[model samples]
Target: MFISLNVKFDLFYSILAPNVIPDGFVDGRQVTEKLLEATQLDKNLYQCGNTKVFFKAGTLAHLEDLRDDKLNGIISLFQAEIRGYLMRKQYKKLQDQRVALTLMQRNIRKYLVLRNWPWWRLYTKVKPMLNIARQEEEMKKAAEELAKLKEEFEKLEKLKKELEEQNVTVLQQKNDLFLQLQTEQDSLADAEEKISKLVLQRGDMEQRIKELEERLADEEDQAANLNEVKKKMSSEIEELKKDVEDLESSLQKAEQEKQTKDNQIRTLQAEMAQQDETIGKLNKDKKNLEEQNKRTQEALQAEEDKVNHLNKLKAKLESTLDEVSLWTKWIFFNIFHSLL
Candidate 1:
């Protein structure tokens, strides 16, 4: 009797999956580690060494079974892809065969059933020419429609170009308007600053006017005091005149009894003249103060007018700024709406 023995090789190497090993990797220990890490196999079944792996008695068998399953799964995936492609090819062939068979059946039925009829035979003989004429007419109509479509397309293209140009112009205008708005805003800020400065100046002017008025009041008080002093001097002059008259009467009655009487009279007259000169100077000073007060009032009036003018100017500028802002808003709204 002859006996044949079949032996399977590689109990340990078979456990490494083909997909786990990189190209040019030949080290057994690295391959074992990669396979173990990739597969996450139970550590109790195998031990890793410096250059080899030791497996328990049944571990090699189990790993080989797992490798076989993985290989089978890859084979099955390839088989499914090939089978799907073949099935699609076969389905297309079957569809063509079915259409050809249907066409042949229709032709056989027509030949067997209608071949003997005179009208059918005549129609068959004339059908090609009639079909040709009809196709020619349809072709003519199609050509006319195509020409019309070409003309319409050209018109649409021209219109699109014109619209694009208009849009560009509108965008340019919008940019110009935006720049104008920015300039207006800058001007408005400057105007506000000027107005603020004017307001502060107005306050200063008012304060100065107030100070002038107070000074004028003080001058009036000093003039009243001078008038009182003048009145006291006039009373003393009247008393001195009366005393001179009495002394003259006594000199006449005593006839040269008081020889110094003439000297006292002369002194009294000189004092009167000095008092008159002082009165004249006081009147001139009062006139000067009156003129100064008048000038001060005129200056205050001018300042008030200046303040009024500045207020009017500020209002006008504010109105203009408001109008510009409104116009800018309108332009922005219109531009945005048209773009949308």
Candidate 2:
């Protein structure tokens, strides 16, 4: 191929080589030179001239093959970019569709469950009574109120247990206080009769407490029923409140104990007229027990108030809970500490 491409050859020396040249500098000869350089072919196969090039016939075919391969690759790259963009756009739309369907399914399920409950039926019926034209998002208000009521009912159940235990403690405390009063007022017939009556009343209270404890298990089941918890819980709470009121009745023994102490004081004063020191000491003891009993009565009354205001007590149990907790612990405190 090299020996065949010399200017001495008729093809190279022909008028055709000068015909393929530049700008006239960029015409046939320049195009031919660039193509020849890209192929790194034997230079003898072609000759460039001032205005033209001369080449063997098959040389132009090599340039044609390179051009076709380059155009096909660029077109393929453009097609791949467009295909990727379309696939990503379609995938994003599909993901959004799936998410929307999931949310719709979730919310609809919640609404259906809430609507099917017995509480929901009762709420829908009685909504008018509360003037429940739902606003300020009143449904939200109703839901909050429902949660608050449930919390109160739970606290009441706990309080009922505490008060029952504390009731026994209070009764036992009263018994001890009166026993002291009995010792001091032993000579008085009136004091003796009253103390005997209180003892009988305490026996009746113990029997009543036993019956209430047996009833506790049954009521506990009713309180736990979620479907009827709202309406039935309120009715159940009212009955428990009555039981608490009966608990309050037991503390009346305190007032009777007060009378017994007063009588003892007077009898001590008259009998120990010369022994002024013993009289003063007995009087001092009476005053301390009175103060303690007064505070105890007030605390029980406050517990009753908390029972009534269980709804109002969102968080503030304050010292009342502390005192209530101590009620059981200090059950023996009065028996020993007060005597000492």
Candidate 3:
């Protein structure tokens, strides 16, 4: 077919080779590599000449030259080419056009069925709503996760507060235990001092009892000597006999006083024995307290509940010690009264 000297042969070549023109009758001769090369060369030459036409090198834009040609001449040449091709094909082009038209109609029907156009139009209309629903679901899941994290954080904070309270309670308990221990130690010291005083009092009472015994022995010796003197003077004179009788009465009185003193000594010994028993009991109690103190020291590192129990035990022990101290004092007073 005839073509304009300046037609975009390269454009036809580039498009037809990629099958973009669909049913166009393009062939190897019309879209040759040589034709494309010539078209690119002409564009570059025209560009170098600085012509008024705007065309890119290495492309079919060289066809801009056809725009300067007479419009009637182009139409006449295009018609002549069409008439020559149609004369040779007779009605074959029409038949081919009819077939192509039928194929296009069938393809259009298949596309409509496959795409489901009515449903596609509905989908296009509701797509934003579906997207919004999906976004809402994602937002809900994120909110749930955030809430769960916040709950966990609150639990951790509560646990931290509980631990702080426990720490404060433990410190308070430790201080209380320290004060109680100091008080108990002071009480123990006082008890020991009292016990020492009791021991000194016991020694003084024993010494006094020894001196009284010695005096009683000396009085007995003097009474024996007077009895010998009375025997010697018995038949000497009535004066001497009267004198002996007086001395005998005095001796009898001295014997009665010695017996009374002996009774008092026995009573004092009994009181001393009671004092010893009391001291022994006190010593036992002190030992028990020492053991309990040792246990308390051992349990210093134990739990608060155990420390509280120990505190109660200490109070009971203190009460018992106070009772024991009162008993000891009463016993000491009675012993001293008897000695006096």
Total clashing pairs for each candidate: 0, 16, 0
How many clashing pairs in candidate 3? Answer: 0
**Of 2 and 3, the candidate ranking higher by lDDT:** 2
Expressed as tens digits, the lDDT of each residue in 31-119 for candidate 2 is 55654665567787777654235667786566457566666887899999999999999999999999999999998998798987978
TM-score, cand. 1: 0.30
Best by lDDT: 1
Model 1: lDDT to the true structure: 0.57
Worst 10 residues of 3 by lDDT: 46-55
Question: In model 1, which runs have C-alpha deviations exceeding 4 angstroms?
Answer: 1-127, 223-340
Clashing pairs in 3: none
| TM-scores vs. true structure, each candidate | 0.30, 0.25, 0.27
Best candidate according to TM-score: 1
lDDT of 1 by residue, 44-115 (tens): 777775424667787777766888887788899999999999999999999999999999999999899999
Query: What lDDT does each candidate get?
Result: 0.57, 0.54, 0.51
